[model samples]
Target chain A: MKVEQILHMIGGVGGNSYANNSKLQEKAILKTKPMVEEAISDICNTIHTNNIVVADLGCSSGPNTLLVLSHISNAIEKHYCQYNRKQPEIQYFFNDLPSNDFNSIFQLLMLYEEQLRENKAADYVNLYAVGLPGSFYGRLFPTKTVHFFHSSYSLMWLTQVPQGLDEKNCAQLNKGNIYIADASSSIVYHLYLNQFKKDFSKFLRSRSKELIFGGKMVLSFLGRKNSPAFGDIFNFWSLLADALNSMISEGLVEEAKVNTFNLPFYAPLMEEVKSIIEMEGSFHVGQTQTFESNWDPFDDSTDNFVINSTLSGQNVAKYIRAVLEPLLISHFGDDIIEDLFSRYAQNIARHISIEKAKIVVLILVLKLKE
Target chain B: MKVEQILHMIGGVGGNSYANNSKLQEKAILKTKPMVEEAISDICNTIHTNNIVVADLGCSSGPNTLLVLSHISNAIEKHYCQYNRKQPEIQYFFNDLPSNDFNSIFQLLMLYEEQLRENKAADYVNLYAVGLPGSFYGRLFPTKTVHFFHSSYSLMWLTQVPQGLDEKNCAQLNKGNIYIADASSSIVYHLYLNQFKKDFSKFLRSRSKELIFGGKMVLSFLGRKNSPAFGDIFNFWSLLADALNSMISEGLVEEAKVNTFNLPFYAPLMEEVKSIIEMEGSFHVGQTQTFESNWDPFDDSTDNFVINSTLSGQNVAKYIRAVLEPLLISHFGDDIIEDLFSRYAQNIARHISIEKAKIVVLILVLKLKE
Candidate 1:
């Protein structure tokens, strides 16, 4: 199988509804839940609603997923008790592409099932969760059914790997790696822009149909400034593939089948995202905020195991496992793999700065008009 | 006859080669002499030249014509005496359309004959002032024959009245006035622009042929800013024509004679003029200056004779004299002519700021490549 096919299969795996590996996936969900809760609060205030139906689109399997559900439940419970009135019922939906590991998401929900029942108060709060597996580009719910919607860290993923990348005209020889030529940037940008416009317009239309009057949505995602100097991030995997080819050519490792890879998603500039939303015109802008994060801030980051445990989980570790051995062998010979974690620790202690590991997030909250 | 043809006829009258009456022509020439001397001094200072061959393109019948010639002569003579070297020879070619009043120009030149004989320096000065009556758009002399060229207040005369003004579409309404709608501002501007580009290109090519390696051309004419608010100036003539139609309809004027009337010349923007000169890549920009004439100055208490006299000797007064008087009388009644004049004079007295009457002058110097 081609390298692109392998990467696509992995992306498809994350997108599917049936995958059940919850233990490894739950950590990211837990970490992101508080941020999602803050976003939901802002969204509620924008809509002037104490009770609202919410959906987490692209809600992958993780402990963080239930934490988000719990946050919403707590906010609604507090609003009712303080006002001395009937509490609003909550219906939370977990959505992803059909290929995502939903069993893991389902298991995490089941674990929280008992706790939700025990805390049920007057006006009968309900915890109903369902897995929705489909492309988010089109209508997925009935008209005027949703009150608020939220999505995060997902919009930057391209629908498919770029075609014709292997063609001689598509790639140019630059130093040792095959880099894109002058016309490549425009071609890729247009290709991705067409897909994004189609998908985003459909998403807005679908949401507009489903949203009740005064409903709100909070979305956080990766974007980029429209400048010639910034290359489209869709090419990240292709560049990595080229680097791998160089390592393979140097006889760093035996030829082994590798089918799956991930694209790094970064937050885009505010202007580009605003342009798309404005073009759709279904929602009025409320608030936009940008925040930064440092994923790996340890002083001695050279201990690969410690850093991996702190920042990411098994999925990243598994992917890096294949390349790590080959990469270390090629650069420092076979014996260094055992001591590589110590070397990384020392290097991190000596040179790593907190600023270098930061990630930027941009949040946009919009309210749907009647 | 078309309006343009009428203007052409008037312009043609100033091109005649022999004098019909030398005495009256000499007096007009004398009256204009001082202005010509000042103009020559200004030109010399602008071009930084003490000795140069100066030709007046469209010299016509004027007392000031000899002054420009004599000024060139004096500049050369003074330069030679002061530097102890041979003075520059002056070859003054006075040009006009074939039908010009050249007899007057020649007679005025003859009146300076005795002064030339007494100078003694005239032998070395070598003044050869000749009449070249033809279109100034094409070559009239040998290559590199002249050093300076001047034309004042002449370019405003259009080469011909624009064609097709009598067409049905050119009439804005059925009342016999030409319609500005069909013959729009752009249409009029472009019509003149086409003629200018054609004529000026030929003129430049011809002048380039006659001008020495380093020569200067000074041109002054009536112009206007290309603004829609100021469209009144260009459209006013049409409105006056409409007023004439009103008079004819009322049995006060002859309709048959109106066809003979025409706008004399084109008024181009400063940028347009500069572009035409620079298009051939033969000349560089030297200076451009614009000023508006103030027709009134007093606080509405003085007689209006000053403003009236200023307009009397010019072509503008002669062209408007026929239509203006009747239009005023018909509109204001015979008894009010004095009142009309008094109102105009009062307005002038109140508002005759010097800035209003200023003219625009653009000077360009070209260096011929060997």
Candidate 2:
């Protein structure tokens, strides 16, 4: 099936079922809380409508979806409160793939609404919410319907595995690996780069049409600071590739299958993102900043509940598995998953003990100048 | 895991996975289309608000959820056009269990909204929808927020199975069956009756608090004709019981397990319904109707698409399975399900061939006196 479909099935958390392990996502959101508030204020300043329409593209439902809503609602209310102006009603659009756990989101919304009422904050802002399920690569809303949007850890997903890199289309050019690495063929790298360009441009074009002229969107996703080829970003994938490569000799996985399986993801640099927006989108970048984060956000001793074991590598592996398992399972069969990830965790622990992998996330606030 | 949790996990159907098997629900909804239209007309005629807040309690996701929305939107708009009144914006709240497939609902809603825009009907209705995920027997919205409510083929499900009827509570009060039947003891019948009274009354109390004084609610659910004692209401469950009883002989399932596993449902008569409404609910019944549908809506050749396989019994079994499978799978191990259902189809076929089994659905339009 499609990746969107797969994401929905495996998405959520520590729960045994379909929960996506989203704790790391929670940490990223916390770090970007101030940016979220700024974006809300920016939109409130520009939009003069009786109702504010806010869309959180690629919003996975659960505690985080509600958390985003609460923040948006509070910031907008505060904007009005500061000026002694009545806050406009809010129309929250939570956009996710068609397979998202909207049930959890909706239920969580009800609880959040109750919390607001209890806190006497509900009357300050009339809020309504709905889930919009579709890909952000194309138009999902009517023209001028959305005024503000927020997406984090989502835009990095390319439209699909780059077309020519698939085994069906070409000879697994990126042999014995599933993602970009220093050793991958130049053609493999180009295909991935071209896919990112096409997908990001399409995303920009679609959002430009959906958002009003003065609308604002704040996005934070995995990115490379100085350049898109930073090795730290790929080290996690590199170890996973090594684990898969080890299995190849044991006949656990086909080398051709590994070569064809490129992740539909790209971590763009700040400059690359800025250029893309200028050329492809109707918006101008108001601000761009990169945050350097430890590859394991929960590595802190205080929050060891997530990764109870002493082995930080296994903890990181579990976190990554929660995300990449569905994608890997689709490309390779289920039988190889256990051994592959075990090997990956061992390799990562060996490396992390020496030097922890680091990731630089680029956060951008954009304004619709046109 | 709890059945409710399990239901949330395994619900939904189709290529993407986790999609609800709602084909039978579609057929029942189609049959009730005119009734829905009538209810919508009645509500629109009496209520006037800046924005009409409507709640469809027990609204299942998929094509039917959209179908209900379309009918509701059309009826409200038609009312305004006929009276030359300014059409109020519509805020739709689709309420269902937390386990419902709201992802499908959201995706389908996006498509429906597009079709509306394409037809230029979007301007007529400033429609907004949000999912309300909770049991309808409790408060789901703010006080006076909702002006009207609609429910169909729901409410028959009791809030929870009767308290003392469980195997642990009593001696499997209604053994050899999953519901009330002639074979069941008077204690079993009374337990179901009391439970329905409690659940329906709680439902009314919750909704009363949520809606304005003049707010109206329309409900249609499985019911029997003349009186609650009519065996036709229980006949379906009886056949299912027989299928399980057969399994006891073959050692496929535990007899006590089937005995203790009564479905959390009740189908009442018009007289019984009125008595409860008068005693418990604050609203007065404006109109009462009973639709006598074949136990199999597809019994007629014209509507055979729903059950194409020439066996009416099998068709009914499938319909029931789509709805009750999650619940059954939770209670009885999945091993005996297929065999049990196959036997159920065989037994039901025998009964239907002799005289097509029938169901009486009671639809009531209720209004709260100011």
Candidate 3:
């Protein structure tokens, strides 16, 4: 299936919706707040125009979508105050795939406006929010128009699942696995890496054309600390694969289905991400940082300990389900979702009780080269 | 209820959806195609930039939304070819209330892009479509950015249901009516007219700020040919009011509910419309036309003859229901919608059998004053 056609967070404000389960992603945004502020300040100082076009690429709906806007606006507000400069008008473009829940974003904007009115006086920044629906892997704006771009927890998604993984008359390259795992052969790892390289390079080139020279972008997404393909992030898919495998053994699901399914995502090493950006040759990396976030968003401990493993496992599973359930349903159908996730939660509980699980996040502040 | 909160065409592609029953609106768009083309030509000639921004205000979802885009692009394409000039990039913003069905529009956009790919070469116009959700009664764009604006069949909606229509312990201004019917008091007529004047002036002021000096706008909405509060358009609301009264007498609906409810809409005469544009002072009226359309969209007969009045009545009722059902449900509850429209259909059929009913539409092309 095409990744762009089906990849979207669970929509609306239901119990299982992405809006409710996006704390893990929000932490990453908060982690990079200083970087975002610096980027906005740089743009304000360099770009002399009074109107700035800022876009949030892959801005899935909910409070987080507006959270990004608030960060940028607050930064601009602070920058103008510090520099004693007149506030500029900002036109914010919240962009994502066509199937993303833009309705939720529009609804949140009304409340955002009301809150802005209550907090700020007449001298506040004039902000206009618009929903732009399309993939960021291609051109999304006019040339040299956007002044600042921000994306969070979105670039790991490939434009499509890796091709050539299913050769004619050959077993699937990543059989019994949905992502790069220990069981997967070297060829499987390389295929996923190549897809990421192609998608990320195309993304940079597209944004470079859209951004004015010296325009700034702040991007944060999942990555690995080490150079190896099999890192801590793989545990997410491995546990999910184990659940599907158990279902297959029970004759509840087909083994062939598990073998054929693969996620259109890759958690690349920090080195690999840096190399691709250099190879793309359009952006100058300004600031970069890598940090570890626990699999369970609620577990914010400095040491390697999993307190209440059962609850932590459920929290991790819920967050993952919010991000992946729609894509899974599109491929595997709805009947298997409940059973698969429950077993996956049980597996996570057992595994984390023995050892803590962590996911690495990478944040970057890049500027378009003149 | 706030008009912006409750006023939206029936959403989705269901049986009662606006998408399925917008032939009357489509006819108005086609009739004004020449005016839209001329406006595009004027903008292309006067504006020196290769990137033009055009907005369609109150662009509710469905084929009609894209139809406006097609009209503008075709105009741009033809003008460039005739002038032997390079085709400019057009950024089309589709604006509507937050309650609109923008998801349907985004879904249709994929098909639009695919069709463009198949039908044209790479040299065709670069069109980027974005959805802007908010009321057109306020500013929606940055200063001096928009080059052309188009709105169709949407301006008849007042900002609210004429504030002060209900006073403490006083009789309803327009008793036993949902609009300015013949039985409506002069005070009721003045109330609706004042609302329209206030809303239309605010709309003009907002668009004038968004548009570049000398930018053009083409607006078409329901209007009367002569200067009178009770024109041909009154039949539409009088019939609907009669239907509600029937329900009130049958105990299906309450008298207080019917008395308190009035449509947040007005159809002004040509003189009133022209006078408001002159009073607004920011626009130079270019071209104006008034025409008649059959109340039964399917009845194309020129003479005052009603062939198969029942079918015609049902078609008319479906069209009106597509636009008003949601608003009615919000005010009177859902239990009365099905019965209300059926009774409205019967009333329209009886009225048209005696004499054909018609609706007047006013079209105008105005340019922002330099």
Candidate 4:
């Protein structure tokens, strides 16, 4: 089964996939704050209403789920208060996959609301929050109900692994690699691109319906620039391939297995994103800004991602493992995941020590076409 | 709006309701395990199905929520292994109000599942857990789907604070007190009794429909026994009333406010429970046992509740405040909650210092009536 079906299924209950190693994701939330506040500030100036609905699409369960809500609320409140306008009732719709850790989100939401209510010293802040558990690849709300939509580091996920990589379609099409590596065939690249086009178009199509006219969405996620350097998307996947290659060499896993497996992921370049938005014809897309974050998950530094000489590749490996292990385990089995990630971390650290490694995130603020 | 409607409203999010003060509730969970396991053991033997669905109704968001599920799972596993039978897949449904911190439960659920899977040494477990967010007083699951049921320390909440004590009906039906106090009239007692009867009967009716034939349920909740000499429901409410009396004398709060206010709580008498079970006729009611706990929320001693000589009534008052402060604040205002609970604690300390105080909890194991 693909990700949509097997979500929280194999990792079942204990899988540390998202809940355990969410530090990098937390950093992603932090890095995107300016873009988020910028979008909110613009919306506050233009979108005048007594009721404001803010949706955090693909808002996976964790400390980060409620972070964006508070930021948006504060920004909106700040703008209204500065102008001496009555603050509208803010309704926060925290949307995530049904498998996302919503229980934790709800628990934290209460605690957050408690803190907000106390700080505001109001009987009620007129803030309402609810969990909409479903896939963001499809529609999730009453049409035109949502005003502000925010997502970070989630658009990289394709609805499913590219259509043809398994034995069901071919014999290890992307040989000795689970995702795009430097050695991958032209066919693999094209297949992934086609899948990305389909998924991104569907994503745009779905979101376009839910957001109100002129509503703003800040979309930031892992993507590629043309330069496939050691620190970019190309290197990240290549390093992971490097880890799997060691496993294959050690005979821990069949080379055939790695060849057959493919990640349900695709990193779009800025040009590709522009083409899709132009091709889709739904959004007045704003200028896309490229952001560079550290491969080191531990690096909470909002400053430039300077790879400290002491920092090992394991930090990046841990971050990748936290997000990707579940899918890997689903394909390669649990026996290989720990060793694969450990070796992967070492490989990444070795490479990055020689060269600065970074992940490129593409941030775009889209306004629904009036 | 009643307790069910306003929930965290008047008390505001800053208010420390049962959801906030879960350590004591965790203590309640700890104090009532043998009974829980006993019921589980009996069900494991009697209910022979390939699948077992266990539902924890009123499973408030806290550290203790996932505890009960683990205890039930381990006990079932133990029972089946002892009999040389294959263990069935257990589906756990964590049910609570939409407002309950379900996020904590879900987050903890994964951690718990991870621990269980590790302990069992199984690559994958047959267990499935899902959050069922709704009220337990109504239909929650597929009819006749749930096999075993458990609820702890939550049934005391009468769906709405016994009707007619509000301004809409009249001025202070139960004069000079909030709950059933020594100063309360006969009508006040009867109103609470009738409300409890209705709510409990509805609870049984709802569960009876959901549970399979011969399915068993273990319910442990706050109640009162006839031996109301020193420590019982009698003094707990009276102590709270004493605090309010002191407040009235201080002129900090209007006596009319105290007279008009009432708690959305009812401590069922053992006889009252027995009669309700017999009257409902849905379950073959088993022997009902009464357990007493110290007014001090910290006391987990199963041995007779020995009130510490130095323990002031404030100890008990604090415990009550932690659980009931939200409801009281809703009836009164935020300004009085802190001061009201402070005086309540002092009054309770003074009263209980002269006399011992304890809380009575009634435990019952019910079998679906054939």
Measured by TM-score, the strongest candidate is 3
Candidate 4's TM-score = 0.56
Which residue pairs in model 2 clash with each other? A11-A20, A12-A19, A12-A20, A13-A19, A13-A20, B12-B19, B12-B20, B13-B19, B13-B20
Evaluate candidate 3 and give its CAPRI docking class based on DockQ: medium
Worst 10 residues of 2 chain B by lDDT: B301-310
The alpha-carbon lDDT assigned to residue A310 of candidate 2 equals 34
Worst 10 residues of 1 chain B by lDDT: B4-13
Which stretches of candidate 1 lie above 4 Å from their native place?
Answer: A1-52, A119-125, A162-186, A224-243, A251-267, A295-355, B1-370
Instruction: Report the C-alpha displacement of residue B62, candidate 1, in angstroms.
Output: 99
As for candidate 4, its clashing pairs are A103-B102, A103-B103, A103-B104, A104-B103, A313-A349, B313-B348, B313-B349, B314-B349
- Tens digit per residue, CA lDDT, model 4, B244-268: 8788898888887777777778887
lDDT of 1 by residue, A205-281 (tens): 77887787766676766554335324333232233344444445666422231111222122346776678788988
Candidate 1 at residue A351, lDDT? 30
lDDT tens per residue, model 3, A97-161: 99998888888898898789788895353888899989999888887889999999999999877
The regions of model 4 sitting more than 4 angstroms off are A7-20, A227-231, A300-311, B1-370
TM-score of chain B of each: 0.65, 0.90, 0.98, 0.89
Q: DockQ for each of the predicted structures, in order? A: 0.00, 0.21, 0.68, 0.06
Model 2 Cα lDDT, one tens digit per residue, A1-370: 2565565435544452234456667777777789888887777787776678788888876666777777887888899999788667776778887767776776667667667778775344277676666778876665566888899789888778887876465654777666788777777777887888898998888788778877888898988755445478778788888998898889888877876677888887777788888887488888777777666656644321333333767767776776677777777878887898799888887777666567777888887865
Error of 4 at B327 (Å): 17
Q: Best-fitting candidate, measured by lDDT?
A: 3
Candidate 4 per-residue lDDT over residues A1-370, each given as its tens digit: 4576445311212445455556767776787788787888888788788778788877876666767787888888888898899887776777666656675666566578669768876644456566665567765554566789998888888888788764545646777666776777788888888888988898898789778776899998888877332226777787788778787888788877766777788888888888998899899888568877677877656654355634557667665766776677777788887788778877777776776667778889899776
